[model samples]
Target: MARVPTDSPARRPFMTAVKVMLYAALLGLIGLAVAVSITYSQLPSYQTLTKTNDLGQTIRMRAANGQVLVSMGPSVGKWIPYDRIPQAMRSAMIAVEDKRFRSHIGVDPIGIARSAKVRLETGRFSQGGSTITQQLARNIFLTNSRTFGRKIKEAVVALALELKFSKNQILELYLNRVYFGGGAYGIDAASTRFFGHGAERLSLGEAAIIAGLVKAPSNYSPTADVEAARGRSSVVLQSMVNNGFVSADVAAGVSPAEVKIQKMTRQNNVRYFTDWALPQLDTLIDETSEPIDVWTTLDPTMQVAADQAIGRNTPGGAQGALVALDRDGAVRAMVGGRDYVDSIYNRSTQAQRQPGSAFKLFVYLAALESGMKPTDTLVDEPVTINGWSPRNSTRTNLGPVSLREAFARSINTISAKIGQQLGFSTIADMARRFGITGEISTYPSMVLGTSDVRLIDMTRAFASVSNRGVAVMPYGIRKVVSANGRVLYQHDAAEERVLVAPWVAAEMTDLLQSAVLTGTGRAAQIGRPVAGKTGTTSSNKDGWFIGFSSGITTGVWMGRDDARAIAGLQGGTAPARAFHDFMVKAVANRPVEQFETQVPMPDWQLEPGEEAWGAGDNAVEPVLDENGQPFDQDPYVYNPDATAPAPPDPNQQPPSQLPEVSVPPVRQQQPTDPSRRPAPAGSEPADDPSQSGADLAQ
Candidate 1:
């Protein structure tokens, strides 16, 4: 009877359907095997992963004062033995991430079914399909890709991990390798980054907050948002109550605010410094499967000063960067842009711009090295090299002026003449000697700093001058140590290369002094005999003030990122003022430093029949009496009988000149002190701003 009905109308269709189901089920099993085999083949070698550090590499950066700046990467936090792990942290982890973490082999089938049912009922997933073991497996051996293939691989690896390691071992790996917010990896790092302590010391509240972060670290990170983190913690607490990890009364007692989080000062603009420095590990050490602690030369105080200075002084819609270096070229402070949130591009080390008159340092150093004295007279006239005619910013032809006079006044004509005399190759070589490693154009215009240069490089070059001629290599990392306290790298303090002769540095410092004392950098004056130069490129596209005070060389650059000009912006204005503000605080604790050995710089006399070029925006010549004489002399001392000039115009601007033309400020007024005056003239007048305001560094 059974055989007769086997092929009947109803039975025939059922028999075919059973055959098809069998084939499909067989194919599905085969596909599952292939996926498992492929995932196992692609898995990283885990024999070395006996402990928390087996899978990740972390980098921890600190300031000179041992202040932890940032701890990032897979293994950033502390790694304690299994017994040392906090019970509260373990309870919180199990409560939120996988309540059945201890009982499940790897993937939690019941949890997945429950979550799927919730998703169907509520139109949203209330729990993740993956368990803690699956997450550990994915984080260790897979990517976060949400594709079905990745999910298959995740499950396969989770089973492998559960089979290979004990229940406690799997939990240890999962707890230590999970990602927390703010560059923290592992429960220890998350605890340290958020609570400023190791995971072993985490309280119930702190542990719960951290456990909640596993769902969406960035969205619920306390460091990223306050209310969002609190909200997420509330959810985690309810999860603990639901999972029976804690009673509802116990969960209710856990207040998010009761958990003390560390101050967030480390998350500021100093990230610019860390971002620049982290990549250096490639050269400093061999690849390792452990975290590293990098103690840097960053000075927290100086970093703050630099940030505030740039923020307060940078013009609206423009960006500014400041790099301060020790005399030996250790970077102390760096501000890459106006704000890190607005942009991550590090202008200090990445953006290359013309330094304008600041580039004159190379030409003059080359000149001095070639035996040309600061007192040597050079004609400030139209001179063309390779079809490039160099003109002063003031456009007033300063006939013949001494080297000191031309340099202090930022005389583009004389600087170009010096560049011509020494040859562009010679100037470029000098720049290289002083730590400018980038491509320097040897073109005639390059003599006037037409070639691009990084702000960090310029600051380092000037550091050589302040270091008394020793060459500088601007560096951030001072020491690197592994997690096991093995010394991986350390800065060489014995290496010192001379970039210039002491006499040459002294001579350059003398000219720089004249610039602040009598020329375009008067705004940088800080009630002391500081030396620096001001630079403004054509159309005021780039403004620079690189100077040395108390052995600290700071280079400041302010301009639009697109290289457009800011109206009324000059090196002597925003950049110089920022420099002043930074340096004043930077050197406040340090004793005043003077150029130890200065080459006797003469008050170079103007050539006969040629009057002194009036000071531009950079100078404050001594006020002279009612003589009403056209300013013709360098008055180093204040003149008693000079008229008390009216307060300068608030909107006073540097005399606008054509592009590529450099000039000394032609306006002369008494500078109660210069540059603080809007007219570029002061009560204790220098010469015309045409002489003082000259800038070809644009």
Candidate 2:
């Protein structure tokens, strides 16, 4: 009775279970093989991982003087080799993320168990269990998707990386490619973005804060909330202490206030210019793995001045944009809005708003091109074409006026008549030749700027005139250099494009100068020989002022994004005033420039031809109010006690030749080099922030 038979019922049941398990194992292997076959093309090649591990090139946009305007791309600030990466930054990351990083092959079972236990005790996940190598594998060759297949890929890739690379190489890869926060990918960029310096200079406390951000970048972003970020930093420091990376006293020595949080708004404003400039890179160079330096035409001084002008002078609730271009078409300063934070939709480049009177420049240029002189007699009377009638703001037209006088006065009837005579297609072609882009519709009322245009295009068109009729396409990039400072592409300014005859620009200048001196653009006069035109559309939905002096052309536009009317807003008030303010600061340090040998302002048109060309009772247009609407009564009368400068005396004669603008008292700033910048508080001498972009070029 003691011996059990080998083929008993219990043994048979065990054998059946073994067969079922074998079949399940076979099916699982078959399923895995099928999965591999289906997804092989999408999966990264593990053997090629080492060769393709080059970190993403960080695109650093810098002003002319090398002040970094903004940075974008896969990686942050700069690439740091494992050796150059500050010891504290590496230590803090290891202590907080994977204490057993040195001993683990690819995964850390001990760390995972610790994390799971802590989760059970706290009823919440308190720590990450993935080793630094696993993270590097995910960052380098895998997506962040959470799935069984993705996890398997991460593990397999991590093992392959550990086999091919050392602990330091894995750490360096992780540090350089990890996403920190706020558009920053690596330590270098995150450090500069948050602390205004490079990662190499991070202090103990700063390193701790950066290490803490991996868990929740947005929540711990110092820019968004400093106190919360400081709390996270403390936790990182305490973890470092527990892991023996730092002593308890040394950990406590790091102060919370030592973390200086720079506001992102001020620095982020330049993104408007960078955003406009970045897309142009696609046309300039093909995408490459090596980093590149985009040396833009941005002048730091001019940029600051332009920003101040728009911020201070733009009418509240109405947005304003400014674009300044050198005669050669290099963009000096671009402020795309009153505040970029309020709107990222670039008003200078993206917004296709009605140019209003600004488009009149195109009309006048076409008029001059068509053999019409500034002195040609043009009647400022009512005119209608295709049942479309044009009337001046005064609603009454002058009996007879010189082309110069009509232009200066911004008389609507004369421009409409000229557009009809010149043909809308002629004006449209003229605009295109002057580098105006996008659809410039050949509508009857296009002469008065009914067709929409970008401020940059308008500015570029004006720049052609400023360049003595030589054509210019407004450009922001001056040169794109390699990370090693090798020039990739440079703008060939010598390849001149003559859009208009020199004589035509001269005639246009004379008319534009008189407009500032004795017509609608009176507010634009800044004690300089300014030449500009004022544009105001029906219902005053948009206002624009574009002009050029000292070989630098600037255009300003004011309007709402919704195309709603800004009460009384006109080119002569806020837009012109902003232009005046920017110019006052922009050209303060540059030498005064001559307008070439141009024709004189017309005094005979006022007196000698008084009978034929009516001696208008109003020599200059009335001063517009804040919203740019005309004053009912002539209110520009001289007031000695006025805080504002009194209006020019109508009885007094203007000079035969326009005078060059006198320099103001403002001081120009040298281009900033962050490498030369004094080390900020709690920072050390490491890689220069200015050189970070160049350093990461590879």
Candidate 3:
């Protein structure tokens, strides 16, 4: 082997192996160059697209009167110039997030190597080596998948960002794109949340505290754990000292005691009102396929007053709702419940219960349309109909009373009688015409509020009456505007005629005014003329006091969700008290007004032994023959005097000899039943012939 030939057969194999190794090295270098060229050619032009074309950013927003009602996600951060950020905050963010942020070209090789070493030692990936530019790239353009493919995409996007934007621009983007806890998505929001100021106004210590929260937001949340937050903040301060961002003397003097972590209060201002009003706005604007800012008619002062009144006057475990609408049915204020956060139920619009005596407005209207005058006499005695006897809430009869007095007192018996006299179908028709969508039964018991009606409908009905019988649909929003300040939708009061006569409306208002002045609605009496009614359902299960002035109409309700009776609660006590307390402040500086006046009544005189009926009958009439003619028979005779003789009971007579009368004429005599007679006027016998003759002979 010492003098081996250059072309020996045994050495030929070794020479061939060395030639093969050289050729493989040359081919590998050529393939690497081609791969690099291909990869560079495939890189996307992300630098040309400053904004991504993604649909994930679309948000549904609701606003009222140009003010935000609710935002589903964090607000988008407004871009600030790099100089607007405080130097201390900027340096602190760099020290904690990316120490070589300014020096790196989007990727930090030293950070990656150190993180890889730490991961290897810990046998798990605990630390991330993403530079600030890389984080901005990922947040703005890349998916959040923790895989090699996504990491590659993030790296490519970061490199593209560095090539397109300057160092200051990249830093500003990173500062605005980061997430801080408590619904904050940028440094500006974080600054305001932590110190109640802007990011540019943050002190060095406050800036460090906010910067420290990026590592673990929940652990360092000033709201969740104050002590842990202080510890984390101290570490950030030490980092600032170590990096020469802050002086050693300054860092030492900055004690944890000096760190003022302001406790965030739950934003209780109009949270519930905004929640309830947003869906309404959505319905009003969704058809246009545009974003809208709803301008409502709500007065903030009235809303606050209503809320305070409900909170103070309502009993424990008892919830209350109040709605105040202007004369045009524009909702001025609404209190859904005590705490909307605790219960999302909007009792003012959602809850439906028997309106109790408050429903008598429709009944009285029916009576008025049936030609019953407000001064007409009605007996408030215990009456039975088809084995169903309705008793007044007072449990005692006031004997004979005028329609005005009976209505003012909200007597159940009189209401039932009037409803029956006018026909239950007529009352049901009236309720329907008044925009009451609740199911109303034909039964006489419905006169006493056996029908369930929502507070919204009831308030709207009252608003109609306050508007002088012009029924207007209740609406919360006045107009909706787009983000660019264009009108997308509008709402105005739509009116319709529901009452037959303006005089009837005036009479009803008079009766309700009597209720506020001298009846159960005394608590709701204001300095001005107010017409209202107090209603309590059976067993006090529901309490309601709905009233109105010339300017506003308010309705209040108090009850439990379970329909359980609140002990010692009534409309006049809690609901009326709340209404009064609220309206006192709500109507402040508003002019006083009087309700419309009643129609004049004609004066008339009756002779001795003569009884004047309510425009229906003068006396009881006898039955008639079936041939459509009156008969001279004993049982078929007409009697005008009660002392003359007692009329034979028609049911006891034989069928063949029984007399028949016209249905319309017979309806008049039914009101003269001995059990349903009105009390004598001035203590004189109204129908007795013997007593009348004695008074006349005197």
Error of 1 at 300 (Å): 1.2
Q: Comparing 1 and 3 by lDDT, which wins?
A: 1
Tell me the TM-score of model 3.
0.54
Give the per-residue lDDT of model 2 (tens digit) for 1-698.
Answer: 67778688869988899999999999987875565444444544433543423556678888999998887665346677889999999999998888889998787888778878998999976766778888987887777786768877776666666766779877887787688877788888789888888888889999999999988888888865678899999999999999999999998889977778766655556878998899899898876767888999999899999999899987778888899998788899888887665556688888887676667788888898787866567776767777676656554455666677677767677887888898989999988887777887776767767667788988887777877788787788988998887898897766887887787888788777756655667677666567888777656677788887777789999888777777767778788888899998888877766565243335643466454224577333334566876544212222223343344456978554332321111112123322222111111111111221221221
Segments of candidate 3 deviating more than 4 angstroms: 1-269, 286-292, 599-698
* lDDT tens readout by residue for model 1, 221-337: 877776787778888788888887789888788889777777565349998999898888889888776778999999999999999999999999999999998876788999999
The full ranking of all candidates by lDDT, starting with the best, is: 1, 2, 3
- Candidate 2 weakest ten by summed lDDT: 679-688
Q: Which candidate is the best by lDDT?
A: 1
Q: Model 1 — which ten-residue stretch has the worst lDDT?
A: 681-690
The parts of candidate 2 lying over 4 Å away from their true place are 1-54, 71-268, 597-698
Which residues of candidate 1, in runs, are more than 4 Å off?
1-58, 73-266, 286-292, 481-487, 597-698
lDDT of residue 221 for candidate 3:
68
RMSD of 3: 18.2
